[model samples]
Target: MLQRPTMPGYAAPQDLIRRVRRTWFLFFVVAIVIIAAALAGAEFYGRRSAIEALESQGRTDANLKVALLTAVLERPRALPLLLSEDQQVLDALSSANSQAIEILNRKLERLVTGTQAAVLYVVRPDGIAVSASNWREPLSFVGNDYNFRDYFRRAMEQGTAEQFALGSVSKRPGLFISRRVGSAVAPLGVVVVKMEFDRLETDWQSASRPVYVTDNHGVVLITSIPSWRFMTSGAIPQQDLASIRSSLQFGDAPLAPLPIKNPAILNPGASIVSAVLPGSGEAKYLRLLAAVPTTPWQLEYLVPIETPVASAVQTARLTALAFLLPVLAIAAFLLRRRQVSVMRIATEQAMREELERRVVERTEDLSRARDRLQAEISDHRDTEAKLQVVQQELVQANRLAILGQVAAGVAHEINQPVATIRAYADNARVFLERKQTDPVEENLGAIAALTERIGTITEELKAFARKGRVAPEPVDLRGVIEGAIVLLRSRFSGQLNALDAQLPPPGLFVMGNRIRLEQILINLLQNALEALGDRSDARVEITVTETSDEAAIAISDNGPGIPPAILDSLFTPFHTSKEQGLGLGLVISKDIVADYGGRIEVSSSDRGTCFTVYLLKAKT
Candidate 1:
């Protein structure tokens, strides 16, 4: 081997080899650490970005929901008024000749100009499209029948404004609003109003969602998303409709008429998504999907999220640059270390004179840690206090709700007898003043009978107000049923054709407070009695039947059957058919039944309305 010469201030060849090897080993270790750190940082950043992206998506969805709701709410509060105006138009059409109908339609066309409604149709109650804004066919809808629809029935039954069909008409999708024109007893007909759905569709202007409305059927009505008139025609493909039905459980059936909290504005599948829809010369792209059940229009908004491949490629390029820059800086520092070492040594000697630097850094770190711990403790205490307050509020609210239901039933029961007494007394007073001496005697007797009824009402109010603690003992089911009937007898005496009670043998007993059970019985019986209001020959049948573990009290009424829409929600709080009712009678009864480890159920048909309460049997 040839001898290698040594440079000045450098080590011998063997020593240089040893030093270089040691330095290379250290460099390799440092490089490995840097590579590991870089990988970990990249992974952490990626995970953090994903989480942030998800959070941002959630926020965007929430904001879109709010915006769609706001637009729907802003829709012409004048819808009901418009329906009323259409009633006048229809009324005029009923008597006017074709010339008059054409003239009136023209005037209406001018009135609703530039509005979301494109076409207005006045339909006859028989489902005939009577008049349109533009005259096309005279007998076009003359004999069309709409008698089988729930919307038509609703208008006739409730005599109120109602939403009807929301789909295609004359090759165009739209919404139909109708109002009963005549009396509640027998309405002349309904004033039907039709609006172009595209008008409603254009109302919603979201940039990132699919907006469309569905009828009671999962059929899509209107969407700002283009070429989606197929949904409005109620002709969605099977698979797509199935996907929508499964996710949202959509049905044409009307849900219980109870208050619905924030209903979702958009329904997925066979809906406007995954593809662009054609528009009628309006904006084509969609970002939000909004559907309004009140009308038959849905507004689809599409906002484009960045393409994943393009975004990924850009991100990777930036990431690579970030990684390469730190590595290049480390290599450059290493290459310049020799010259910098002497200056660093000098600088270190000068800076070593300061003793306070290390101490100050340690103190600052300890202060930061203490502040973080204190913030955490404060947050924990705030959460605990909020939870405690929520629990207390729930307890108080439950008590108040129960008390309110009880109070309403009591008031209703008292008012019935009081009303009868007032009628009798007023008749007696009129008889005395009319100088009819013969009938005066009968009226006086009626007044006395009415006074007795008033006394009964007072007693019932007192019993309902009783604050005594519940006392459970062996009690007769027949007695409870009869006592409740007695309290409510004045209410049903003449109103109902029969108040028959069929009880089992005297051995049927239940372990319950007599008064509370009586209250439950009265609630059920009163409901039956009230349902008999419109029946020609009203009757209520009460039967006591025994089960293996419990005794069942069944009350059946001959009034109109409970509405299918309301039957399920009847036991929920604040659900009632009566306009002035507190809607607590059935809810309180259910709670009482549950307390006894029993149940109350209802069955109804055209035959009558039947309610059965199952109570645990008392040991003899």
Candidate 2:
């Protein structure tokens, strides 16, 4: 082999080989550094996004708890105010006559039968209870002396007061609502209604979510966990504790602070804190608080953060590694190819003229290699973009779809119990509202009214069915219009103000079943009402005009006119444009009119629609 001509300071191929080794080592180190940085950034971003979602969900739960508590507290407030105004309660308080006291006791029992109140009692001016709803029980509140109770003393001076305390006789805790009878100047006695929250607490506990309510002074008044009840939310001064103890409001139990500490505030009314809930070890919780309405109380709700945050951090790190590994691999492969190219150039340079010609070819090869490398890089970048899109899709699916499926199953299993509890809440409120009126007489009258309504519905159903058809009679046209409107008003209550009815002159009659003729008009009128749903300037007009042989009653509405496509089949059975209904009204109406030797005519446009019933006139 011919050797290259040597010149002064000429480089050897051995030196270039050593340089390629050094470059490869450097590339390896750089790739490691890039991977470490990517992991760190992913972790931080993932944790921040997860925490924001956690706080938002915690706030919603807090609001629901506050609303339920407000409903429970406001129900019994009516009891004391009503009793304070009763003449029998006033007479009983003024004089301690045994017969009047007995009468008042029985009356209180009747009043509290359907209410959620734990007890309803009347207190004398000296703070002695003379009548109680539980007067017949062994632990009756008939003779309990409430002179030491803050609710009784405050009502004596302030006309009305509210206090949450433990009952001395029942040894149970409840909210006591008291209102003074008569006036502050000449006070007769006090009316007291104690409302318990056992059912409310039970419902909350069943949800397995930690929640608690605190008074203005930060003392726990209601809680899902029994161990947390009567506990202070934070530090209480010695003086305040002493005053609370002297009032005997909570009895002799120790009021220690709740088992939560070291809160790091995340936002207003939200925090991350270490809490020890019952039946679980200590964990970090995102706590949210909301103020209960109509009361000086705040509710705190807690949600654990470990499981969700950890999942987010794990998903983020895996995605980062997945994106970086392919890029690093491509870099390594390109570096290896660069080393091979350098060695090829060195070998060619030993042959002088061949080296010159190969140099140009090598330049073109390098350009082509660069273009191929760029293409490879672009392909990898596109893959990385698709990977990111897939990761986001997976994250969204895992968070919403899977969680929603589980939630739906849980909701289905617990629907009945939750509905029953809500029904109880609704019924209690309704009972209290009615009790404010003349409850005894009004309740009996309501039962009678309901019975009469049932009978009326039965009679109407029988008439609509047309069972045992009656012979045709002289049906007055005016009476038919009135009856049809009365029947239609029930379905479209509060919407009849748009109706403009024009009745026929007296003595104008038709030979048809009275109810059947009414049915024909009812169907037309009901369709007009349904068509004019919620449209502005809605109107329905009824005109009764007579020809020489037939009586025509036309019903029309200023609604979107019936479509031409369906108008041809308007009276066909089971054909309708409405979203609801059996589509039998117009068909039945057609049959009824046909049986009476009558026919229907329809005219429609974009502005309005009209259906006129033509009936044979009777010789009246």
Candidate 3:
């Protein structure tokens, strides 16, 4: 054996083939794993992006529904509150005379037509409808008893009430907005404005996605699907159901769970669920809910998820396959080339060492330069942080300065209302002492009105001081002008009587918040009034004009005009000619106008001073 070792037996062809097959199988398995991992990563990223897009669309749709619902519901709110205090409504309720009732009914009829209200009615304390906008119709609310209705009881007790329910007579689902008439002590009646969402529902039905609104108890009050109406999103407890039934909130309709399945919450206000459509089979949907402010309701939007999910998965798989083939081929080629290049690599080993030494020297130099650059970057970042802090402080200081300037004017405006209320109260006491019931009631009403005015002024000031605001919408310029004049009436009553107003026609509108626009007008008018102070023949004029894309309002006063020295800096903050002026009025006004993409300009001379505001015209 030591002399000659027996030659090893040659491997059988079958064994050699078996080993090669096993190696190839293992290689394919690893390749499949790599391909699968890549596919999974692609799918994950694709699905996440799709979900984000769906959520964005869901939010937009939810917000749109809220706006539409708010606009429709708000149309009739002022109707009930304002009409409840109307002289005719009060007289009709107090006297119950047929003639007064007739006049009140006609007035209500006109109002209903003008406002597109479903119905406007006045219910007596006994819950009998005394006057209605549809009194002449066969289905008139007049003489109908609503004593069992929650809105009537709540309005009488709470001064105002809002309830969504099926109308007892009309048998239609609507919101009943009610306000109590007269003083709480001797309430005359309740004013009601019934608002139906038939048109809104119709519009929603035409949309691509499903939309609905649910009450506090999760009952579907308004929905795109008629069949879904009056349905509950979840089970109601026995006690709550009994209360709802007693109130007849949804008539005799059964409150059952909606036909939604397997709901998985995605976030606080968004979820994914399966729902069955009338014509279609089971489908997955992304549902989103947004709370409607000022109401105990939520707007819900449902968008189909099947298309997006399928698209995402299919796209990811195709993309992964496209990348996997090239990657696998390149890897195989590299492996073969590495084997073939072994001898060539050994031949170049010495050359590579020399190159590597030079590369190391360069690398050290680059490392040093990188450290110096990183240090510079760090210094720059520190400087930027300090600058940002200073910038924030300056912004805060500017806001405080503006607030201080307007504080005095706001106080003066509020003070006038307080004085008027005090005077009215004194007059009411005198009339009561003399046993003059009518005059005493009139004075008391005036006092109440003034108190409300004071509240409104203070609320406006508070809102102005706040940093946030509602989005601007189309605001009627004429209405804002009239509102400012009314607010300033007591301040410059004698001056306002002589002031000339040349306004555009009723519907001229600009893009801005109504309250802010009114504030601008008030500031302008107050300045004009002060300029014309103590002049017997003083004159102030407000004129509204329009171009193709802009609305211009000019406020002019005939007095010793703004001095030339201060004319250029008239709108500059803290710059004023008046002895007691903090000078933020014009600055604030300019800012407001600019926020609406408008401009303010002033021209002054010895003859007179004029301030003009230009605002973008709102699309009709």
TM-score of every model? 0.35, 0.54, 0.53
Q: Write the per-residue lDDT of candidate 2 for residues 1-620, one digit (tens) a residue.
A: 11322422234555665687678778888988898888888888778778888877767767777877888888889989998999889879887889888899998998888786889999999888999999999999988899999999999999999999988899899999999999888999999999989999998887666888888878888888999889988888889888889988899879888999999998888888999987789998888889988888889888888888887788788889988999998888787767656654675454344435545779775555556545754775698689989999998988996555444333322332233334444545577777654554554454454344444434533443442234567888899898777655544666898899998888999988776677677678878887889887999999988876789999999998889998998888568787755566677677668766789999998988999999988843
**Per-model lDDT:** 0.57, 0.78, 0.82
**lDDT of each residue in 1-620, candidate 1, tens digit only:** 11222212222335544555566577667877776666566655654454345335544653565465546444533553465445457555467567666675676566556455544445555555455554444434333555654445576677554442433325443445556655676455655445554434554433324554445444544445544433443345668666544433223322222111222223341111234334322321213444544444453334333343234344544685577768766785675465345433443343333223434667675455446545754775698689889999998999998787666666754554465556656666787789777776775675576466556544644544552224367788878876676556645667645677886677678977665677688778778877777666878888888865689888898878888889878788778888887786777677667656678999887778999999988853
**Alpha-carbon lDDT of model 3:** 0.82
Model 3 over residues 465-498: C-alpha lDDT tens digits?
5633446799989999987776677557667776
Considering only N, C-alpha and C atoms within 3 Å, which residue pairs clash in candidate 2? none
Q: Which candidate comes out best when scored by TM-score?
A: 2
Q: Which stretch of 10 consecutive residues in model 1 shows the poorest summed lDDT?
A: 253-262
| Candidate 1 residue spans exceeding 4 A from truth | 1-116, 136-143, 148-153, 158-169, 197-220, 227-301, 307-324, 331-620
Distance from true position, residue 412, model 3, in Å? 78
